[model samples]
Target: MRIKILSIAFAALIVAAAFTFIRKEVKVDVKSSQIAWVGEKVTGQHNGTVNIKSGALDVENGTIKGGEFTIDMTSIDVLDLEGDSKGKLMGHLKSDDFFSVEKYPTALFKINSVSESKQADATHFISGELTIKGITNKITFPATVTVNGDKVNAKATFALDRTKWNVRYGSGSFFDGLGDKMIYDDFKLSVNLSSL
Candidate 1:
């Protein structure tokens, strides 16, 4: 009777261990990660970087489950210009004509879902809500996500229409006859994020 009881207890312990999940929440390396952006008009374009304020990622059994990030809108940089020109553009971006960063100094992104991709180049597809200047929109994009014990690296290139978020300055969609001075509605972002 004792031997039978011991065998049953050992079997139950094995079953419980098998059902245990391996999951972790990792904070992103804000200084090492970057978000690059590009805005274009008919004649040319401006490119810059925005700083990430804070972020964290959830991993389930070595797969990216979800994450959320906050961006410092006041940290916008116009990389191509120099001196006063850079300052002017940066100021304009922060003003009401553009992002109104003084009023809304932060933008946020919350991941809703992540799925493994069938393609070789991209590791996963992501769907999330991106909030800019206090407006939130659902955006979906593909990313290359890699996981190595305790570390995660993710990269993606995606486009967002500024007008969708009520940023209508120089946009032809709202005003006509702008000709060459019209700015395109779509702005691009290249994101690279690292978390541990």
Candidate 2:
């Protein structure tokens, strides 16, 4: 009878240790990480960078369990243009017709779940809520997650519909006969996140 009680106690200890390993959490390095954005029009495309204000990752035995990050929308920049054109385009992007940065200065992304990916090139399949201009939507994408000692690197490329967040400036769905002036609804974002 005493041996049976000892066996049960040892099994409980093993299970507790396993749970402890799965509860590790890490904070992301906002300065070292970045989110690059691409916006396309019928005539051309523009690319730029946005700053990550803050973020953190919940890691379970070196696998990403969940995470969240905030974007500083007011820090948006235009990399493909220069001089007056750059300033003008930046202004328009922050205006009421676009993000309205003054009114909505930040965007947010929160991970709902993450699963280990079976693909060769990807490490994780992540599903999350992306909020822009106070509108939230679910986005799922595959990312390459690399863990080296204490450092973690995560990268992903995905697209989001600007109209869904109420940024409909030249959306073809809202306007007709725009010809070359119609901007595409989806914009691409390439994210590279580094965290300890």
Candidate 3:
């Protein structure tokens, strides 16, 4: 009986040590991360960028177990326009008709799960809850993630329906007779992240 008890305790210690070795928490390098946005209308398309405020990732056995990131919505910048034309668009985007950056200056995404991707080019499928303008919604996208030593790099591109998050504005679904003034409901976001 004594020998059996000792063996059981040894097994428990081994399991605990293995678990500690497999799981890790890493801080995100917000300065090195980038999130680009693209919005289209019947007339043309506009592209810009937003900053990542902070983030962290849970890595387990070289795979991302979970992660969360905060976006600085007030950092939205238009790259295609210059002078007042750019200023006007930026003002409108921050107003209540769009992201309402004054009321909600930051957006957040928290990962709920991650799974190996079946896509040839993608590494994993990440499911998470995205909160914008005080509204939270579930979003899933494929990402290419790599881990080397203490560093991690990830990239993902996905489109989100603005209407689902109550970003109505000139959306054709909410307003008729918009014609060319109507902005498409879906907007694309491309994210690149690196670990500190």
Question: What TM-score fits each model?
Answer: 0.95, 0.90, 0.92
lDDT of each: 0.94, 0.90, 0.94
Error of 2 at 157 (Å): 0.7
> lDDT at 183 for candidate 3?
97
Q: Which one wins on TM-score?
A: 1
Which segments of candidate 3 are over 4 A away from where they belong?
A: 1-21
lDDT of 1 at 83: 97
Ranking by TM-score: 1, 3, 2
Rank the models by lDDT, top first: 3, 1, 2
Residue-wise C-alpha lDDT for candidate 2, range 85-186, written one tens digit per residue: 999999999999999899999999999998888988788888999999899999899899887655789999988889989999999989999999999999
lDDT for predicted candidate 1 compared with the true structure: 0.94
Residue-level lDDT of model 1, residues 97-153, one tens digit each, is 999998999999999999988987788899999999899999999899989988999
User: Which residue pairs clash in candidate 1?
Assistant: none
Predicted candidate 3 versus true structure: per-residue lDDT over 79-130, tens digit per residue: 9999999999999999999999999999999999999898988999999999
RMSD of 1: 1.2
